[model samples]
Target: MTARTFQATNPATGQPLAPAFPVTTPQEMEALVAAARGAARAFAASTPTQRADFLNAAAAAIEARADAFVEAAMAEAGLPEPRLRGEVGRTANQLRLFAGVAADGSWVDARIDHADPARKPPKPDVRSLRVPLGPVAVFGASNFPLAFSVAGGDTASALAAGCPVVVKAHPAHPATSKLAAEAIRAAAQQCGLPAGVFGIVYEDGHELGVQLVQHPDIHAVGFTGSRAGGLALVAAAQAREVPIPVYAEMSSVNPSVFTAAALEANGAALAKGLAASISGSGGQLCTQPGLLFVPVGEAGDAFLNDVAAKLDATPACTLLTGGILNAFQKGAAGHLKAAGVQPLTQGAKPDSGAQPQLLSVPIAQFTPELADEVFGPLSVAVRYDRLEEVTPLLAGLEGQLTATLHATDAELDGLADLLHVMGTRAGRLVLNGFPTGVEVGHAMVHGGPFPATSDGGASTSVGSRAITRFARLRAYQDFPDRALPPELQEANPYGIWRLVDGERTR
Candidate 1:
């Protein structure tokens, strides 16, 4: 029998792209996982400096092919050139940051204590360091095709943490994923890393994802997509003989709060910013401000109308796929059909691209449905009559990736309740800024609590901390100094900060 195959198409024109891949069968997948496991031991044994070399080479290789990748992403993911280029830059930055983490060596989280010869129980010499957790399985996201794809944060972090990785390519942009994967493979070969240190599965089968999670060799998983998809991976991984950590960045409506004083001071700018954020990237961003809470009165009147006018004037933009566009439309239409929700702007949608939409619901009529994420250029504004309504409304929100507040210095004092509410509900809080674009740095957080993510976002899938997800801790008791890993040695040759005898020292 002929083997099954998968094809990728241009979302804009529905044209096929190059390099169709045969579907990897269940038996083939097992073999692939086995190969990755074989490579993990050698890859983990290499020094951090050696791993950093691979990450730098991979980043350079990916950047060198930026033009070709941007073109493929344009066709397959319907992203504009500037956005795709920025995404490429973001991915490269993440790689280099992980490289720096390896060079610095502190990511190992080393802790050591000399043998307590005279202690009550006589504590032996115990030295512990973070170590790789075998192979990792990464699922590429449909949106941010490059930054979240083959050579993206998950791959970079796993490699940085000395773990082998096997990526499951997202079907929406199969050709783009293949190109990125090739660059990573080239870097691995150039660095003389073990075979199968990096691998990609191009099948468009649901079973492929489940099989990857259930694979015994895969010690952890990283994902970015819908709530349903993330949960499925979580469920499959836990049913395994050895359940592993799953860093799944899922749904968030990212609410922007507009205090009466801030709106009065900068109503026009807030309206414009909200308008740009709603339509940004066709609202495909997980951090898109899909919900807004505003105070009623004169300030609210002007802010709502101004936002409506700006949204009505914005042009249409296409989403990543037909499925996403349809789901977005259904969400917006559902709000229109619901009670007490009125259209702020009734502009018609184009046949291809999504049009900006704004709907308003009264505070008394606001439901959990009002806070649902509409993955297009859409937003819902809820008008509160009194300050009392603000607490209950915010309390009803699910854990989010971001919660924005457009408040002035004086307004902050009056918002003690709001400050406390948002602190626990979101991973990041924005002050007088939009949340559509996330900065790539050590302090940045791109994950949150459930339904926003699985495991309540204890670990991030981006930046330096991401490496910890693919690593486990190991302790050596009563081991000679000569036997210790360099990071945990008494001499501290690596010069990294580590906890020594209950104190932080080099």
Candidate 2:
């Protein structure tokens, strides 16, 4: 089929975001894959230092074009300037972080086992090294245009691991994706990398996403989106004869439980924080706390009242897309009308946009299915009679990226057993703070259980650990010096940490 044109409409103003662009035709798609596969061969052969330099150049390009991307993203996504600017910083920071990891040369996990000539029989010398997984298909996320879209974490990490990338740009922020892609393309040219080392595909339909994932030459897939979408892609890849791993960060509730002591101590303040977390970015984060557990009493009602009041005052703003807005409204209405549920407060509907809202349901009626993330500025407060009531309820959680607790040291100690149990349900456990500000550091774990991510141990785009996901280990058995990869050779040129004979050292 001939490719159809796709236009990005501004979420804030309901106007055309920019000029529409035609989707890549199947013929063009084939050529794109061919070029990416060719580039993968060259990129995969580059030294770690060389790849690091290219990544540094890409980060520089992003910094140079930051203003343009921010404007485009703000217009299309209805995100305020402050949030957009921060996201841009995070995006650039991610690229630079990957650059440092690549330059360090330790992500390769070099391991060497010297010859064991005196063994029964003969134990030959063995060495192991990590290598890139070749061309990767990166699916851009709707919410994070810069950090998870064109020049997003998947693209940055894949490049850091010396793998070529073919990105399927999200339609929600097409203009922003295009601008970031331009910067990356310019960086590739300046760095003397192959043209197809970074390819961008603008597709409004799911066919291109399917094609990109199912492409025989693509070695792996990286995705950040909904549970349904991520799972569908995984199934498609598995249907292939040579199944490739799809690292998809999908749905999460990011449940937060307030101990009775915390709730009774500072229910009002906690309610305010919850309001902002639920309403920020129109509640568009995967880590947004959807299920809030509080003790049922006058205190619970007081906390809910404060949250309702804050939400009532929150100004209604446009959602990222009309489709999202529709879904949000439908969901908000559904929860409000659901049995044993009540609306605490509703924001004044902006003359032009949807408003923020808070809804609550009794524990008996708030089933696990109702806890599905609504993807808008809405929250469901579930009241419990005691802390014991929370354990069984939380035990039903499928998977999550974070579980937050607001409690004093003594209270946390009392609930230590519960915290330990909840730890298994999430990748990160937080105390007193909302799970919105995801730090980009060595210790951060952004991916969690089955629904949070296909691989719970997978790192988000933020940390140095993300570099490992794109590389695979290969063991060398009694091979000649020439057969050994340069990274695993006895003479180590790129000085970085290694596990020599399974002992960690530099």
lDDT of 2 by residue, 323-395 (tens): 8888777766666667887767755222223676766777778776677877777777887877888888888
Top model number, lDDT: 1
Q: What residue runs in model 1 are displaced by over 4 Å at the alpha carbon?
A: 348-353
- Candidate 1, residue 415: the lDDT equals 86
Candidate 2 achieves a global lDDT of 0.83
Look at candidate 2 and give me any clashing residue pairs.
none
Query: What would the TM-score be for candidate 1 when compared with the true structure?
Result: 0.97
Give the Å shift of residue 316 in candidate 1.
1.6
Tens digit of per-residue lDDT, candidate 1, span 325-396: 888878877777889988887563333347888888888899998888878888888888776678777877
